[model samples]
Structure formats: structure tokens, C-alpha cells
Target: MLTAAAHLGACAGGDPGVGSTNPFESQGNSNSMSGTTQPGSDTDSTPTVGGSMTDSDTSTPTGPGPGSDSDPTGSDPTGGPTTAGTTTLPDPDCVDDDGDLHGEGCNAGPDCDDTSFNSWQSCGTCVDQDGDGFWVGCDQYGPDEPGPDCDDANPDASDGSDCECAVTPDAKASDTCAEGMAGALGVIAEGGVVPPIKGSITGIDNGPGNGQEDWYWVEFPEAMAMGNRPNAGKIAATFAVNPGDPTSPDYRFEVYTACNKPAFEGLAATYGPGTPPAREWEFFDAHSPPNPNPNPNPNYLNNVPWPAKVFIRVIRVANDQSCSEYTLQVSRLPT
Candidate 1:
């Protein structure tokens, strides 16, 4: 009865074909089993069953088992969270205001123009206000900075197109001296003084008791107002003369370029004095030597001798009579 009961326990445990059937053999039929046996059944772990290892791929989920591995949704095993689009921030150290990276400085610098800070867009860069071609600073906007002067203090003053001044030309006026007894082209009186004329004691053309004459004189208003001449000789006095009577033997005319008549005392000294005295002429000759008029007609013209301050005189020869009408133009030539 004990042996039969023991055989019954072996059959209840498992099929006995693959292992020793002895109940107390220690190697029971149920215990001698492969890795595929039901749970709680005696079997070696999977590692010892086959010659090769069948490690379950944990990275790829096969089924819903706690120890079984492997992902089911095709998601990357090592992948982290996801992001979208591109980054959009300027590099603080990057001088390039725009990411393009050109110009004087890219990263680690200031923008050339500040008002328009967009680095890649237009309207950015230092500009010359004066148009001198040099940039003012890192930027062209804001306060008026130093550069080419576009507008100076004066609205009309600037370095612009129409503000350039013309340079003076190289030239000078030359000095000059006058000639002897030669008259220059007369310049119209520009409001100066007249020549000196004084003293009256005439008895040459008239015999002592018959004389009354019309006379005139001239002088420069100022020494500085005289015009310059190209030559260096003394200028002579010139007069235009007209005699009214062609047949009056006692009729005569005279003038003195000097300040006064000669020192001699007589009728001749009174009218034809050689050296002029201090104050003024008593009487002097207007006539030059031996008919100074080359064409001695009644209407001929004459050039008088140049008068030194005290060395000139004039005279006229005529019979005893009163003087007649005449016109006289006198002038000093330039020196």
C-alpha cells in the first residue's frame, strides 16, 4: 500500500518519461524540466536552458510584463523632450549687431549707428556732417558731432558747394617820377584846394598910369592827392592863351609859376622878376623867351617853364593900354 500510494504522488506531480520516476530519487519528474514549464514547476532559470543566451531586449518592449523590455510606440529610447523653431537673440559679446557678421566690428563691439539698431537693415553707420569724407563717430544721429562742417555758425557759411572764397591775385602798383616843363593829361578836380595867387603892382604892358587886369592862380589842395607818372623828370606848367588885339604895341601878358617875383627894384623887376620873393608875386611874365609860342598867331598855344617854388615868372609885351579878354588853362604835370 505504501509503494502504490507513492507511485500515485509521482504521477500527480508530472509526466515521468523525461526523468527518473523514483518518488524519493531527489530528481523528481516534475523537478527535471525545461525553462518553458508552468510557474511553480521545478525548472532551471532561462540562462542554463539553451547553449546561447536569449536576453529579453529591454529597450524594445515585447509585451506588457514587468521585467520584459522594449518600447511599444516607436519612440526613441534615449530621446529627451522636444523643441520647435529657431533661436532669436543677439549675442551680447558678438559685435555683429546683425547675425550677418560684417563691418568694422561684429561681435564684442557697438553698433555704427544707434537710432537704427537693426544690424542687417539699412540706416546705420557713422556719417560726416561737413562732408569731409571722414565719419564723425560710431554713429551719425543725435547731437551735431565733429566732422565735415555741413552748416557753420552762419547759415550761409559751410563746407558745402557754394561757400568757397576766392584767393586774391598777385599784383602791385609801381612808383613813378615826373618830367620837366611837360604837362600831363589833366584829371578833373576831385574837390581839392586851389593854387595861390596874390599881390598886384602891374606896369609892364601899360606905361605906369594905364593898367587894370584880370588874373587867376592855382595850386594842389593836398600834396598826397597828386597822381603818379611813369618817368622821373620835372613836370612843366602849361597854359592856353588867346590874345584879343593883334596890333596893340603896348599890350602885354605875364604870369609867375614861382611864389613871388625877383628881388630887383624897377618897372622890369616889378613885372618880369627872375627870382620870386617870399609872400607872393608883385607882377610877373606869362610869356616865355622870344615868343615861346612856335606858331605866334593871335590864337597860338604855349607851354610855360616849370616853376620851382621860387624860380619862375611870366610876362607879356604890349603898348600902353588896358588888357582885353582871354582864356587860360594851367596845370602841373605828374612826377
Candidate 2:
């Protein structure tokens, strides 16, 4: 399980799979909700570049442009038309009775229950933080998460369109082990961090099950020349959402030294699902940079910046590989 402290200091050293919140905490954000919000005049969540999320109060914008419930052309103080779709901006004196940065809708925001923090009218079904839909599960927030929208506490992110996030071309590739050298998405130098490499697995509907695999090549700096890079580099991967059955993971990936040899061999060969949350369904492995013998033999890579090369192959092992996306992160932390 990824820890909180590790994520807070992520940038100091790269932290990919290590998430921010505690997974062991309470679940069940499953209250059917409705609404939309902007960055907000109150609480704002800053997603760290290192790929961690942290929430805190910041300087309020004058107020949000309008809420999901806003009246596009409605009454304001002057009784003219308003900016929102009938949703009014909060009244100037609309002090938030609840600690949640959101104000009361009566004040022209979405907070119907001003007495409660982050409260919303009960759809009484599933908790949709963005008020997108009732599909996402309460405890789960991963792409595959059945739903709490990852951070259950947060009031923003994801308007809930299944597979709505654009699939970047960089994350796509032919599925095969090309001879012995598959074209990699990119390389990972010492102390480098690859945020999230998303890949889609939309298994064919008719027939012909997949015999496919992904290729990711990472060449770490040599041990002696690692500057401030840590001795070990880590690669972590997890599906965005378990589109089918969360308990039964339909996909898998493994680390390799080359096209044939296993990188984690005796340590850990494959990475896949674990607990319920996709974050918990992770495979995090570390490898030390290859150390070259001081006694120079016929080593052409002696002066090379990166000599420890590893191949990552994401494989479709499940018989029913649903149409879902996966995220892979590689981090060579400074620490």
C-alpha cells in the first residue's frame, strides 16, 4: 500500500504508485449527488506534478463563474439576469457554516445543506462527486473503481463519461515482441519520472481473443554515474478502471531485462490487481542500476550515461479482457 508521507514529498524524489490518501480509511462516498463546481473561491486541490494530489484552502476567486445548478439567465441582487443557468453566485455575506469550502445554494451556490461539510441532496444511490452519474462506486475511485471518484473528500474532477479522458497517441503501440527489440514508448533516465502512461484494452467483441502485449523501455543510469539518482528505479502499473469485474483482474504486465529475460525474475515477475481500489491493484518493483566492473574489459557501455536497460511488457492474460484503460508510471527517484 502506498503511504501518505511518501506522496507529500513526491517531488523531492519521484513517487508514482505511492498515492496520497490512506486506503484503509472509511469508504462509502456513495450518496447519489448532483452538481458541478469550478476551482472554487475556497478549497482547491492542486495535483502535484510528481503525480500526487493534495487539498488545501487558497485565495478565493471572486467566486465560481456559476455552478451546475446556476440559472443561466436569472435574478441577481439587481434582479437582472445572472451568469449561471439560474444558479446564483453566493451572497456576499454567505459565510460557509460548514468547513467545506462550498457555500450554500441559498447564497447562490450548490451547498443545499450549509450546516454540513460537502453535503448534497441524497440521490440515495451511488455517490458521484462530480455529480456526473450514479455509476461510480462509493469506496472505489479508480478508473476501474466501482466509484468514490478516487478522492472521496474532494468535490471536483471527472464529469463522468466512461472512457472520456482522451487517449494519447504516445500511449498506443503495436502489441507484439518485435523480434527482440520492440519499439518503446520512451526512455527513463536517472531521476526521471513518467507520470502516467495510459493504454487501452478494448478486446474484440466477436471473437479472436488477444495475444497482445505492451512494450516500454527504460534505461537507467549506471550505478557509479548515477549522480544523485537513487540506487534503485521503480516501475508501477495499474488499470484505470476494472471495467469488468474488479475482483477478477483481466490484465497483467511484467518487467523484463530484454525481450526474453525476466527483470524481477525471482523477486516479482508480474504486476496486477491486489485489493479493491486500483491504486491497491498495483505492481511496484525496484531495480538497482547495473554496476560495471572497475577493471575495464571490452565494455563499450562503460562511459554510457544509462547502462541498465529494462523492458516492460503489459500483457492481456484474462480471457475476457474488457474495454478498459491502464496507467503505468516509472520513477527514478532522487532519494
Candidate 3:
């Protein structure tokens, strides 16, 4: 029996079987590794009893192991192995040199200059110099006649759509009341000043040739220009060069009831003194005026009260051409 078992062991080493009949497999893989290789191994799996573990059949299969660079995971969708040292790169098109969070062709507007930081965006040949969404030399407020840009240098003033003076030139056509109706700045609200009424000052290049002046018509909410109403509504007017210092103002402004030859006054108390809605406040004593006052003018048509017209004349005085720009603003006082 011992002789027979030795012969069987040697015979099975040549072709190890994994079936129930093979004595090597009677025990598990670890226990049966004496002479033959484990079940389901390569054809050269068998080794000499006293020799090293090498494939006897040199024609053995060669390939990457389960997850050895050959599809790192068995379930890899691509079904291909990943390269050794791969790196991710940024998108070349999404360039933003300004570091302003907005990229070229990918923001509010196209970046005109990718090399320079904080540069303006291209608006045709022009650019939004102030980043105010309004373009310089391009987005001028015009339809009837040609007009200049709506202060593209200032970020606060976009297009002149809201201002009483639509940033239209001082005098557009020939036959106008002074410099024509520059604009109508809506009604005066209770508290703060309305949007500034902007107009270009007098210069051979800007305003009309004959005694250049810009006129704006506005209305107070209530009718009290001449103290006709019990409760009065008054307004405070302020004038400043568009790019001037309030500390040292350098513009001249006047308020009138009409755009007449000489312009009539809007006074109350049946004329003389005690005018309720201080119609013309040239001094700006920081005091007061009435809104619902009556038109103190001898000709009521010229100086009508309340909802009547309040014309503001902004003219160039001792200011440079650069300071030739002016803004007239009105605020209502709670009487």
C-alpha cells in the first residue's frame, strides 16, 4: 500500500486533477501544495519535489493582475488601464487675467484686454471705461438728433434715461425756449433729491450761440407755489458742476415760473412778501419755502402755482470747459 501511494503521488504531479478522485485535492489547496500546483493553475504549475516553483511549461499566459494598472477597477467603464502619471489641466479658453471673477466672452461683457488687469470691456470700437454698463463713444442718448454719451466716465450715471435732462445737448433744434426743453425731471418726491438733471454748459461747442442756457421743467407733488393751499409743499434746489466740488461750487442756477422773455416770479401773500412756496431760492439760506402757494406773478399764466411749471436755468459761469457740465437737483421739504 505504501509503494502504491508513492507511485500515485508522482503520477498526479504531472497532471493534477481537482475532481473528488484526486488524492491531492482530498485536502484543501494549502495542504496539497507538496508536489503539484493548486487547482486551476497553469499547465507548468507542477514542480519537482526539491526544486524552485517555476512554470515547467514556458508558454504560460502573461497579463496585468486584477487591478494592476489594467483597468484599475474591474468595473472601469472605459475598459482600459490608466496611464502611470496622469495630470489634469485647466481650460485654455476660460481666460481671466484681471482676476475679477469674470472671464473673456463669459461675463457681463467680453474682456477687451486679457493682458491688462481691470481693463474695460469692448463695446464695438468703444469701451465701458467706468465698468458702468454704459459704453463710451457708443451708447449715447439719441434718436431724433445726435447726442453724446451719458457720462461714460462716471459709474453712478448710466444712460440719461431717468434724468430730467436726458443728457441731451443744451439746445437741440433751432427754435427753442432758450436752450429748448432740455428735459422734464418728473415730480418732486417728499424727502431726498430726485435723480440729477444733467445738461452741458455754455460753450461754442456745446450750447446755443445766442446767450447759451439750459432749461429744465419740473413739478412739485402738491400745489402750493404761492401759498394757495393750507398745507404747503416746498423744495430745495442745489446746483453743482457735473465734476465739481460741493465745497467750492462753480456754477450759476436760477429758478423761474415760466420760460418768458424776462421770466416772472412765483410769490404768495397776494404779491409783495410772505410768498409760501419760496418759488426762486437763489440764496439757498438752507431755510424753507412753500409748495401749494399761488402764482404771485401779475400774469398767472407766466407764474402759475403748485402743479405749475418750475423752470430751472443752468448756465455756465466761472468754470472751465471741463467744468462746463452741470447737474441741477431738487428735493421737497415737508412743510
Candidate 4:
């Protein structure tokens, strides 16, 4: 049997199984290891005895293992598994700021007047500071007219009409369509004196001649003479329709004692106080009583000097209508 076992061990190719099955085999056959696995385990997972532990295959390993520094799946040093999630937070204040409806910060975009709710869309900011009952929303006032000035006080006055100073106790005159005068002459005082009433002044019908018949008149507070009139006095009046052609219509102005009586004062107080009639009539025209025009009468200047009380009238005579256009004037004279 021993001889037979030796033959079997020698025929088993020196494997551990054949060697372990017959220990009496020849020394050459008994050279095989006792067991293929280590003494503690049934598997040969550990490195083989007398075997160099060089990596057998270059292919990646399947799972986690010991003693291996390289990763199974990849050759990179940072080849670990990775996880992912949101990296940033949404901004609550972001909105369409540029008026273009794109999300952006308040001051970063084209929102000029962003503080205003409606102004966020760009354009101009519509705000009306004055309460003039006028709605100036985003738009401007009239072409020549600008925004309201002196907004704190009178807004209507901001338009520029209330620039001049004020006057007290003024006088005014009026007449019907048949015969009417736009303005009247009167005396005014500084502190105690009253100014002429404020009234609209306009020139009579265009006249070169043709008996247009425009009457000019004046008024006195109590019908007093120049001596009794106050020391401080001024005249204010406005005129229209100027004679474009001087030669066309011969024009002149005249002054005379009021004939008979005016509708305002009764016939009782019509005449001035003097001799043959208490007071005599005077003319400011270039003719009669001594023509006032320098060409016709050199003494015209001396006739009705400044600061004189008189009734005046304007006359025109020519082939066409005639009168020089003039603006309203208010001035004080040296008494």
C-alpha cells in the first residue's frame, strides 16, 4: 500500500491534496504544501507563501479591499464618489428694475425715479406741487408758460400778472356803444391821495376822417380847480389804432369846457367860476382859441401847459381812417 500511495503522490503532480492524502510518499512527492489555504481560513484569500504580491492584472478591482492604495474605478487621485445640491439662495429683493422688466437691483438699473410707484417704468416723474386745479402730470405747461412760481402764496399769480405794486382809491369812466371813452384823466396822491380807478383802455374806431366822431373826456373827484387839487398827481391811459399813413388823415386833439352838462353831473354844476362866464373854454387842438400845433401856432406849447384842468377831444380828417397806435401809460408829473 505504501508503494502504491507513493506512486499516486508522484502521479498527482506534487499537489497538496495528493501529498496530504498519503504522508508516506517519497520525499520528492511529499515536498508539496500541507493545505492550499492558510491555517485559519478555508479560502486562499491571503497572499500565497513564497509568492511576490505584485498586482496581477492592471484592470480595476470590483469592490473595497485592504492594502490597495489605488481606486478600483478610476486612476485619478480624487476619484471618490460625489454628491450634489443647490449652491445659492434666491434674492427676495430682485425685481424688474431697468423698466425693461428684467430682474435687477433697485439702484443698479435704469429705474430713475424708483421711489415712486408709477415712476418705476422710466420716463419722467409726474408730480404736481401746486394745487391750482390744473393737472400737470408728466407733461409741461403752455409753450411760453412755465411751472408755477411763488407756489406757497398765490399760484394763479405765479403766471407773472401780479408783479406790479398796488394802488388805492382809483377812478374809472364808461360810455355806451354810441359814444364811449375807454379811459379818463384824474389826479392821484401818494399816501392820502387816491389813484384813478382801474379801467380797460382802448383806441376809438380807426379814423383818417369821415366824421368818425370820437369824444375824449376827463373827471375830477369834487370838480375842484388846479389850485385846490392835491400837489401829488399822475395820469394813466391806454390807446389803440394808429395812423399808418400820416398824410392820409389829418388828426388833432382839442380841449374845451364841458358843453352844457355831462350825464353824471347835472346842469347846475356845468361851468367853471370866473368873469363873463366865471371860466372860459380852452382848446388843445391846432385850431380855434389859438391852434396848439407848433407849425400853425408857435404859442401852442404855452396854451395848456402841464398840470391844467380841461376837457379834451380827438379829431381826425382825411381820405382814409387815421390814428397813431399807442400803449397805455401811467406817469407822475412835476407839479
- Model 4: residues >4 Å from true position, as ranges? 1-211, 220-242, 246-250, 260-309, 319-332
In order of listing, the candidates' clash counts read 54, 21, 16, 19
User: Mind giving the per-residue lDDT tens digits that candidate 3 earns over 152-194?
Assistant: 4456655556223333353431213542354666665544466
lDDT of 4 by residue, 111-138 (tens): 4443333333323434334555332232
Decoy 1 TM-score against native: 0.21
Error of 3 at 192 (Å): 6.7
- Tens digits of lDDT, candidate 1, 1-335: 11100000001222223444322222223312111111111111111110222433324324445764654534345543223324333443444433333334444344444333232222333334345433322322223443333322223433445334221111110011112222222232323222432222222322211333323333332233243211112222322332322221112223334324422222221123322111112212222233434654232122322222322222223211112222233333333
Give the RMSD in angstroms, all C-alphas superposed, for model 1. Answer: 61.8
Per-prediction TM-score, please? 0.21, 0.33, 0.33, 0.21
lDDT at position 143, candidate 4: 32
lDDT leader: 3
When 2 and 4 are scored with TM-score, the better candidate is 2
A best-first ranking of the candidates according to their TM-score comes to 2, 3, 4, 1
Candidate 1 or 2, higher TM-score? 2
Task: For each candidate in the order shown, give its overall lDDT on alpha carbons.
Answer: 0.27, 0.37, 0.38, 0.28
